[model samples]
Target chain A: MKTRYTYGGDEHIYVEIDDEMSLDAFFIALSLSNMVREANIPGVTEILPANASFEVRFDPDVIAPDAMMEKIKAFEHQAEAQEKRLDTRIIEIPVYYEDPWTHETLMRFRERHQDPTGSDLDYAARINGYETVADFIEAHHSQPWFVSMVGFVSGLPFLYQLVERDKQLEVPKYLRPRTDTPKLTVGYGGCFSCIYSVRGAGGYQMFGITPMPIYDPEQKISYLKDFMAFFKPGDIVKWKPIDRAEYDRITQAVEDGTYTPRIAEVAFDLDAFNDDMTGFNAKLMEALNDA
Target chain B: MTLEIIKPGLATTIQDLGRPGYFHLGIPEGGAMDRLAFRAANLLVGNDEGAAGLEAVFMGPEIKFGAEMSVAVTGAEMPMFLDGEPRETWTSFTVKPGQVLSFGFLKTGARIYIAISGGIDTPPALGSRSTYPIGALGGFEGRAIAAGDVIPVGDGSVVAEGRVVPDALRRRPGSPAELRVLTGLYWHRLTEKSQKAFFEDDWVVAPEADRMGYRFRGGQPMEFVDRPQPFGAGSDPSNIVDGCYSYGSIQVPGGLEPIVLHRDAVSGGGYFTLGAVISADMDLIGQLQPNTPVKFKRVEMDEALAARAERKTMISEIRQSLS
Candidate 1:
């Protein structure tokens, strides 16, 4: 269930397991690691697991790297002893793709997409069909997906990949061509799913709509319902769909406090600087000086 | 005490140290453009170095004090007066109740700082009193000071005795200043010719500069690896991963001109940075006005730290001498 490895004298540990465990477990583990205590050892900043490798960063002045490596190895051995110990839950989110602005935008997008060959298209195209796009979205409503980053922009939750697509969509560049890009824009660039935080000009292509606002200003919290987004580097993500009414109901529940939002955090090894890179300290110092 | 603004001048506002640790929430680290002058002006009075001080751009405000208060003015060499009497520059002075403090146009720097012993009284927003016009948050309802705005001053304590910084200690006004910088995120993506030009050529601070960022001319646009990452306003990886915002970030886009980020810039960006103006040189950058030619100087981290330490010591010594 658990494994540990050493990379360049530092501890890189990971846990091997089935995919059903909740992401909250990982969030808690990272938060605890940030407290910097391991078998009475102190000064650790983070223990981050990305791409199946967990890295621990600590103040080298207080603790030796090798000692931490030993602790990680011991911890992994203990984790290996436990199996099927954590409970996992699957959550489904319903998304509605009905908004006047979205409808108008979809029309324009379909027109642009059909540019090369002059083929008359209608909104009734099924799934990938220009026409059935909305219907396909509604049919897949209340589908459960994995959570990536919570409150990415105020309240927008970036979901993990929707693995069901037979073909992967082409992603755009990470950076939009310009600033002042408008809202309700959908762009695929990185490995994860991303939504705009607010209305501004953006390069993301227009996609379907979700009526619920990701961020709730008054509560100062985002309601990222059942989606766990807890996948480690190698974990699998399955995305399912739900209907329009279900989307409205879930959003209403979130807005009305019937649904609780979970907090998801990621930890990375800040101390593990890329020594090969020049001016590394300069960049760190820049942040420090400002601090 | 209070001061009735005769004219708000061009984009005047009260600023302090800034709102830190809120970048995660998409808040800009809004503060004074020239922190040195901001702190210096505060030190001239009895206020702590970070006390809220008036940031006056060229052509400062005309004001009448409602009560006798000790105030110190620094930054731009704008001819200042109280009751029409010529006042010394870079020093503290007493303005009698009902006396008017007016300033002529700045001849050198882009901004002038005016600090009151009591400091300006304004409600803090998002952990700071700095104004962010884009979000309409902080200082004076998140807006620039207007002609009719009455600024409140804190309760008085010690009187401010005028003390002039010696010619040897003061940075010579109008002297050409060099800005030291370090390479940033996308420094490698630039063309070899463009990169060489960046280090060798001189750039002029453009008129479009503000607290948010400074626009510079004369350097060819820096290139990035084929595509930029997610960038946006406010704190979100969507923006960062999306390549929307990059701090201390620079961007050339399609233009020959490059924009260097400053204090009030958004927390994230997606630009190819040739280099960022080092923290120590921020004050110098703040002092530059439109048309001011500046040469970029590269420095080691040690040199930057040393310069920063020296600046801190010099300011402290000056404060001690005055006290």
Candidate 2:
């Protein structure tokens, strides 16, 4: 039996299991334990893969470092005694990488790679695995995607692990910087995937655009509104792409207020005013006028 | 007791200690830029530290008191008069009913703190009395102080005389000062020369500086990270994650001159923050005037924490003296 090692730091803690198979189990067990108050989890803070290890963070005041490490060690011991199949789900996100911007990016990436035998293109194909970008778009019409971090710009989520190709993608710096990237714009930083929220200047290679309004302040019940953020660390993500027409339907659903993306059950209260307010309204109006 | 605004200052808003937590919802914790001065003013007038006080910028408004009350003024050296008589600040004084208390232009800081015997009576939003100018939430009707606006105080009653003012606060400091900083989440990404220039160069606050942020000139241009980057969460690989950051988180998009984020800043961004001005020095930032010269002095985490702890102890003692 191999032992797991977990170390705690000021902001986050490091968790290491004996093997890859134990990753999900370790996360679930730690989450189930009553060792920490879940609310203190830092914004967009979670356990994520770091090469071969996993790192996670929480408020040090809430969950003492030493105790969290012990919990991980205990979970490893339990797993060794009674091994079980890891409960992992596969979610598919339909990707259409056929836009002119995408093609230009791929070409740029190939040039940067400079593979003599066209192996870079082949490597890209292998990671994508579909015959063509159009086929990849067509294969997953009804597949679902997992959520990562929300609250970017305004409720933007950084989702991923789409293909996890062995070939590490190299992303170059922005040639020139502009000031804004609107919401639902798809961008690629080498192999890592990113989705932008609102228009803001960025440096990553942008691939496509989605006009869907993922964040709406008017909806009282939803924090991220049309874009439901439910995936935590260690969740499985299998992407199945849809054709342009189906993509339009999903976006329209978001626009028309009929769409509900997959989400986890988390307590969300909008009326949690913890302090006193005396003259906020008039002050806000005055500020706007002055600005 | 209430005060009717005769002339609204350049900008004025009611602010409390601030709204903590709820950053996951993408709300920046907005409050008084100079929290120490704000709290001190509140305590001098028999008000709680969390009471709503007016943050007056550049100049203060001419206010007509409806009834007799106790008031305290703090933050910078701004001229004041009570019914045409010169009013000394840093002292808790009485105001007669129907008397007009007016403030002259600031000779030092950009904002001044005003506290009444009782707290202001604005509605709380997301656990705060401070105003977020962008979202139009908190403070007086979720807006700034304007002409003809009337702000209500709690109880409309008078309490016993409060403690004597602290010496450190009695003399308002001058503008063009050196600001302390802690290396930010992406300080290492900046080149060595840039880092040196950032700390050594004297930067001037631009007139464009506002509650949302302070724009500075004269510092060497910031260079973007050589690698591709994402927005917000992708940018802050630290615990902050996604959402607006604390005031003083200096962001330089694509290596531009650093813009110090301030109260009422937007909820989220993709820019790189080389450093954040600690809470202790933010009030100093608020006091800075346009074209004022300033320098950044780097401090370690231990030193910053120690300074904060000392401030906490001092504030509590000051509170004790009043009670």
Candidate 3:
């Protein structure tokens, strides 16, 4: 994998580890970006790692761009020699599939969608070769997903499914972006899934909504007391499809400040994961359920 | 002290140097659009350069002061009125206990920064007083200042009158503003003709300009080189795999209007960015009025760094002169 280092103006250095999306690409970016961060390099203000690329915002006044680029290059070399094990967290996200909130939002923005005749879930299911929406929902939560990137808005996680490439669910975004996307709306675009953390403009194909607070500035929820944004890069998420009753119960728990997201910590090795995807995912789920 | 809002002008919000170090969380380093103007206004009023101030766009809000304090207006060349009496902008003057301050229609620029003797005392979210309305994160109640809102202010002890920012030092948009851009990031995606036309064409600022970004139109439609879309890259030729977006990054959606992502920009998106406006030129973009003619000047890395240095020197000059 050739990492292309591109300069963004004077302060930002964008390093694209790969052109396309894959676990391999994300691992390289995450590992190298981590190395760069741990180096405690002066002038490196922000290190933002994405799905396949990473951005380093630096103060050129303190560290010259060419010199900073050299440091990053050296860090990349060190990252190659280092072990690719990431101590990450696996969290259970309860998704209310085909929820009424997203249903109403998708209908309202139907004219901006590729298929105005049916719901976003229907179009995505039909296009992905699923006979029924039930089968599509099963395929969605059948395996875990990686929080490859966290952005677009505060605390929003762009999730990439951990299933084999052939089984990956791919869907196109809306033809035109909707002016409003319900907060915590489960959305799909391209090959990634995302939960809208805030109610704002979005073009992703709506599938469902989550009752749990995706972002709370007040840190109202117990699990999120330490940080306002719950999901971070390197997080593993297992989507659990729930009914309306379970959604209401969880929503109430959230209001009472007693809700804690189901999470388990684990050390992930990309090489080990590549060898036996299903077997490793089962073990990860076991740990999560046990927790 | 408090400033009681009477007539909240267009999109007025509290802003400071902004909360940095939060871009990774998808939260932008949002602050005043015109940072130099905001800083100078604060300095003129004996406040810290990064103090929280009101960023009024296009128009100005009518505010009644609870106590006597010094005030200064900077950025756009708009006529200021203190209780229906004309007052000089860019000059620090004291307001009486109940004197109302207002502004007339803008003459040249889009935004005006108002700095009081003491900074706005709005509670910060994530270490910034800057308003990010999309996230409802900061500023007065996480939104724009409205009528009947009595926003608190820090205590002002020193009242220095006759402090003025000279016209030569103030930032003013030239006739047909020229913005220096270091074009690189996905410039190769566009056809050779499109690349050449991007610099040659004269563009106009679209009405869609805001704190998030400035959209420019009137340029010829861009054409992309023929290439099969990559995996996870949306169907559009303008689409790339979702990636990080930096401040001042310019992304042309649908090969139509070019939007320059600003301080409050979404950190990552799927669209391809042509390049970024140099950091030095970013402050000037915030002052551009809609329909204002503009030219994009292509610059290299060496020149971009030189401009950055030059701007730093200019700021230092402003600081020294004010002190």
Q: What is every candidate's alpha-carbon RMSD to the true fold?
A: 11.7, 12.6, 1.9
Off by over 4 Å in 3: A108-111
The best-first sequence of candidates by lDDT reads 3, 2, 1
Top of the candidates by DockQ: 3
Per-candidate TM equals 0.63, 0.62, 0.95
Please write out the lDDT profile of model 1 over residues B1-323, one tens digit for every residue.
78788889888988898875444334556788877778777877778888887898877888888887778887777888887888977888887788888887687777888888788878887678887665456788678899888888877654647766554545422444687765543455566766777778878888778776777887655443443332211111222232223334465533356776677764332223444655566777677888888777776545655666677777777777667
Candidate 2 residue lDDT tens string, B40-80: 88888888788888888888888888888888888877899
lDDT of 3 by residue, A8-34 (tens): 888899998877788778888888999
Write the residue-wise lDDT of candidate 2 on A16-66 in tens digits.
332222223333333433222343433323433321223444444455545
lDDT of 1 by residue, A1-291 (tens): 133232211111222121112233333333333333445567554343321122354444355545655665555434433332222323322233444454454444342332213211122222234345545444333222334333223323344332233322323232223334234333333333444555542333344444444432223334433321222222212222335676567668756767642222212222232232224323322332232
Global Cα lDDT for candidate 2: 0.55
At residue B201, what lDDT does model 2 achieve? 85
Candidate 2 ranges with C-alpha deviation above 4 Å = A1-147, A152-291, B160-164, B170-175, B223-247, B264-268, B320-323
Q: How much is the lDDT of residue A232 in candidate 3?
A: 88
User: DockQ scores for all the models shown?
Assistant: 0.07, 0.08, 0.65
What TM-score should be assigned to candidate 3? 0.95
